[model samples]
Target: MLISMKNRLIATLAILAVLGLATGLIFPGKHAKAETGKAVSPGSRMEAPAKLEDTAGLTAFVDGMMEEYMNRLQIPGAVISVVKDSRIILAKGYGSSNLEQALPVDPATSMFRIASTTKLFTWTAVMQLVEQGRIDLDTDINTYLKSVKIPATYPEPVTMRHLMTHTAGFEEGGVGYQITTDPAELPGSISETLNKHMLARIRPPGVMSSYSNYGATLAGMIVEDVSGIPYNDYIQKYIFDPLDMKYSTVVEPLPKSFIPYQVVGYNSETGSFIPGTPTFEGGFRPAGSATVSAVDMAHFMIAHLQNGKYGEQQLLKPATAERMHSTAFQFDKRLPGVALGFAEKRVNGVTLISHGGSDPMFNTEFYLAPAKQLGIFLSYNGGQGSEAASNLLQAFFNRYYPAPEVEQPEFAASAESVQKYAGSYQFTRHNSSDIDKFFNFFAQLNVSIAGNKLSLGSGSEQQLYREISPNLFQLEGGTDQIGFRTDESGKVTHMLLDMAPDMPLERTPLLDQSKFWLIVVGVLAVLFIAALLGPILFNRRFKAMTLAEKRAVRLSAGTAGWALLSFITLFMVVMSMDTMQKFTSISPLLSLSLGMPILLAGLTLALLVSTIQVWRNKYWTAIRRVHYTLVTLSAVVLMIFFYHWNLLGWQFG
Candidate 1:
């Protein structure tokens, strides 16, 4: 669920920035220790093979690591499974599954939600159809659908290849309809649900990578159409049956047999564990609704590592499995890219194909090293599961396949070249035409020149990069690489990070930066406050004004100032809600707040007429008339800001 973490982090940072601005404090800077890139001579290094051979050693390593992570992160329960050379190295569970009942997690029976990792099964099902010549990877996806049809937005049609690599160019959505605790909210059918709420195509097919849940769901529907079976039933019969995975299922409100072994999820954000209500993905189930046991996950991993074969059963042809594991798309050749469905990354001098998943309460990580015939699956239930999984992965790779340090490439760039890349950039996996976009205002990354190197982000999360070649920068002491894309005029337009191949960052224009909008808001705040105090402090001057002048004063200063201030106050309140609450559903309070923009637009139009009248009639001193004009201009600016953020109307849909 690295993608989920990225998206949520952006939103979380935005909220923190706004809160910090209000308190006259921005982000607090904390320097991180630089990574050591010292080389170890071959004779000095350990003689152990760079592969998983000793099961006892792995068990000790994993046990120590998981215990430390559980205590440090306050994670309630977790499961870890490792497979090597088609054999299970270890499959174990740790901690309490249900704190209230003191239930311990059972590796053989306890089922945990694997979130987006479920997409692998969906993709596998598609490959099965491909092997049978029932579906073509390059053909238009619309041809295989019977109920929902993809719109012809661009000249090039969206193909299965685009969906597999997340290059279909669909804008991200699925807020209110993504997950729910109520069974009544489940859609009657996937196609019917898609027909009612299809995402708009924002870019041409096969242009760029942007993670999209809707795109994956569409692929699942294609599987259903080609196989003439329901998606859930198809997976159960073809996959689970062949692998003999008894405790795993994609069905929501778990099948009767699985209910007893289901693990309870927990939220540990408030320094205490609180049981979370069960949530279902409804029609979006195919995208991330798989509840699986760690042992079951090991089977799935072993089959993939063995090239789609589990004992005598062949889930996919050898040739088809090889193609699925090969790289299918990549924005930059120098950066880790995407295979058919797996995200490719190079860690400790070893290429590992992996996928991460996250729900509100569960997090999972799956990794396979084809060269070494090793696979690892880890899942934990708690608020800090993602962080715990990340820590474990880094430690596991460093212990097994230590990287051999090489000489650093030397390259210097002119200050002007470095400055050109300095700007605010936003992730492509975001909403561009909806109220969800408002959160993006706070999620931008600010790049700045630091001596001869470049700095990315701010505060504790900041990372330093040095240029290794033209437009390609490498992390100071790490293997991570970031490449910049320039337009025909040599202006940097986008950046691609080696670790994040599914979402590219686009260079934000000046007007779109939060700093620009914050400055405008600050200026308007001062003007509105002065307008409100002007009449109150100068009562004698106000009484001396003529009837027409008084009317103009009230419209320009009295009504406009209060209305704008009211809208701003309401906006801050809406943004202060819990992150999940904001995404689950639009509250009534927010719905009412959306109408404030329309009211402000009318008030601004009236103020514009008042400004002209005051100038034409010479109602007051020249200074007073000029002040009225300035107030009217500020009102217009506020309207433009509202329009840009999609606050001008009800844009939740």
Candidate 2:
């Protein structure tokens, strides 16, 4: 089989598909855990320390934790700030900011891209206007927009509240222009970008949350329209200035004075740090483009913890700040939900209002425990920074506010009852109408049964979950809760996790599951191989065929050849690129590869006509005719797969 090029290629593709499926089956991706320590019973609580009386002890713990994380995760640079009772307990830096120069990160002056953490400031600016009666949270967003109009796809208009809670129902947008290394790529203003690339509304407003970067940027534009100033200028004037955060700025392309302090973002490969180009968020700046130092971020956190008062300067009224921290949207009463712009979660038996940020090169985590009057912020410049930040925060909570061990509800649902919820689910925060939709193939969450309990992940990372109540499951050894939503027929429609309030997992249809497609690909490869091999293996019989029969055979073989070849090409192209390249811009090679599916769709139609001609005229033996029909049907299935994954044509702008 390896002697022929066609056979070798077919075998390779089959092996790749098998490996991909096996990987997904045996090691499903890890889900965020609710608590990092022992489980806490319902209605129970564990209080965090009231004050940082042992600052030196806390410093030693942090220093040891950061050093271990940096070495283990290969993070070159990071900064962290912690505040308790409106006082900075620790604001420090670790590792090197510039590897080549050996320049250390400065907590007070060194700057790092805080990414979507910038959205908090943008939301703060909006709430400040709301406090002054300049804006209303419930009004339709279109009323204040001087430019760009959100289409009325649904009866309910998207409001500021919906945007803040990520329930505006807009499909994912801002691809190809959200982040860029070139300054010339940016539009003149936020309105120009929004108007040119307004996203399609996929769901009804204020229904469900799906983290939308476009929604946040639109809210920033509304701030500009209502306040009569640019979004960045408004933040600098209202939030930054009031908080006295001198080392922070939302302005793209840092000023000359701030340039020397900016840390170099890095990607570690084979024990070497490779510096990445400094990225700009362009018109999406309001969503995640601000740069700030650890000390400056401490000021912003302290203000929010102290009810919007940092010294004499009050960025938001006490009542408005309280409202911002309160729960504004929740899918289920038992699970964590969204609080205005903040994501609410119960970790270590205490409620935390937090927001996380990530760009290509930087990752950040920000959390505020208003009840404890404590806040923590950390950002690192490395490829694995997101994982590092998550681990650090989990360790911090487990050390200082560990949950008390308690009995958890046992598995009460029968195997039949649990079977109804077992399937693949796709996250709601994905592109549904573009080439970017192809990436969703790898983002599915698989649910299965583990003996008597429900398993909530894929692969080796599966976590056992028990049904504490109907449709609500809790992690066996942790506090994480996963709630399922059912339709009128009691069929599960969506799954909500306590750790990720900004997105929900919608149950995927049987035909649309990734495993289903993988099986189809494997079967199609076999049929296509047979179709191509039949001519060569039976050349003597082929010579005796009539003109019509020969024509039919040639058409079927050609169609199968194109299907196999084009699919392999598409696979190779996608596997070669990373997530950032796929989302940021479409290269020429990818554009051409996407066009191949459209050509294959045409060939499949031609092959279908040939199959009908073979049957009507009796071009071959019944068994051969049946095999040819199977090959033709396989071609049709391939076309359906292409269309379902948004690969039939060029869908990018």
Candidate 3:
């Protein structure tokens, strides 16, 4: 009645997925529709207007919508700016910037961390250099770098074009120094950070898009090398000054004059505001370190919308700007894919170029519709801002440009055949090395199929997807879709999650995340507890046994117990906050934690010896033999787990 580690692992994941589904944790279904008229206390200052207007009604409508979502999602503050027909339609802020200080968000002047949207500016800078023949998009990136060299893994070198399109094929980087709320822990210079964190190039350059922050930062480094100016200074002098973006800067350790205008980001999990700490994203400053107000971002948007012209301040040539927005890479020919630094998103038949930014305490989104001459910029100050950002963007597209009527294409399929496609899928955009690889287990997704329709997660949070093509499915009543790739034998190997479509996600063999290892740990716990009770409840039976038998029994149970204990200690340390940063800190606590897995491995060997002795002597009944074999197998699995996580030795760093 013992289980195999493989099956147990699968069962454990399946069970966890079920539990997650029951609790609405993982794949939560659709969110609740917004209620504009919801009543709230006067102190919150969120009230909908009594009547809607036809002329300039968007201002009041957006106000009510933002307030409704903020209250419902527990978001403290948000700023939204929309530019339509080359004129500012609305630029407004709603709710409190700091709940404790009771400071209101100011769209005109209050600066919020714009995160990875800074990549757009970085790309713009690269494009500026390209226009002047200062940098070549097709040239190897190493040609301009002075401090670091990308380890050339593939025959074709990484080029500026690949970086701009997010197709540089660099493995996803940024673990320890990406973003933090503490200034004291700021990573060293940009070049140093990039040099230390050069991730392995898993895929060949220009093969597929991976949305690499490292790639963008390297581009910035190239800018610094070519211009003979600091990355921040180059941006301020060329892009910011020309566009009159007086309030925006990528400068790390932000200046004192801008301190008063910077808004404090909130942490929804702890229900507190993060103090105005100067956290630098190190080399990623080029990728996601820009801070700007909605008003200033609007000006930046205006420049892009105007095709590199902001009243004689030409940041880029008109043709160069056009090329920047044009499609640089296409994953699925039918779907809008990467467009240089921008991502092409089609909603309701209109293609909108956009990019989004996120930090621990902020969520920002920027989108521009050239044909419509529309630009939308919004930023929020808390974790809940994630949901708010998505909802706001969806609502805007739905209201302004509704999809045209079209006949739905029928996909022929049998329910039974389609059901085989349902399982847990793991994202490919994951850390390939280091302790982070172990964290991938947590990203397992549970998928379910009904007829030809696919639903992610379970219950109210599940989003419905229907097949638009044989292996490609689209969200029902939505434009986003994911395509499944099949192997030679017609087995599905990967499903592209359109959000980061380039990140490969293969179906997990385990149906759900029941975590079979945990089950083994639980069994060991029971065995240890039973052994402890033997002296009290069955002392007479122990007295009847020979010394050798007693020793064998003690050793078998002891090893299992030690393995479980050591594992728990190691798990706790690995999962600790800032574990990545702490990995290199050889502090006593971490050293002891790192050593636990070695102890577990030693215990595994002792258990194996006991099992071999039991087999040779034929010591007990068939039931006992089976139990010992299972326990031995479980111990082996634990040893493998430790090895898999690189914990068998002190290889954490």
- Best candidate, lDDT: 2
Q: How much lDDT does each candidate structure score?
A: 0.77, 0.78, 0.68
lDDT of 1 by residue, 494-562 (tens): 998776677688987776788888988889877777776777788899899888877887777765665
Clashing residue pairs in candidate 1 are 1-356, 1-357
The stretch of ten residues in a row with the least summed lDDT in candidate 2 is: 20-29
lDDT of 3 at 467: 82
| Cα misplacement distance, residue 597 of candidate 2 (Å) | 1.6
Report the Cα lDDT for candidate 2.
0.78
> Candidate 3 regions off by >4 Å?
1-55, 99-101, 185-187, 269-278, 416-420, 502-504, 509-539, 546-548, 570-591, 613-626, 649-653
Ranking by TM-score: 1, 2, 3
Mark the regions of model 2 whose C-alpha exceeds 4 Å error after superposition: 1-51, 458-460
Off by over 4 Å in 1: 1-51, 458-461
Candidate 2: tens digits of C-alpha lDDT, residues 397-510? 666776666788665788888888888887776677876666556667778898757785444445688888999998776677789999999999999877676678798877
Mind giving the per-residue lDDT tens digits that candidate 3 earns over 488-520?
Answer: 998887776554433446666542243655675
> Which candidate has the highest TM-score of all?
1
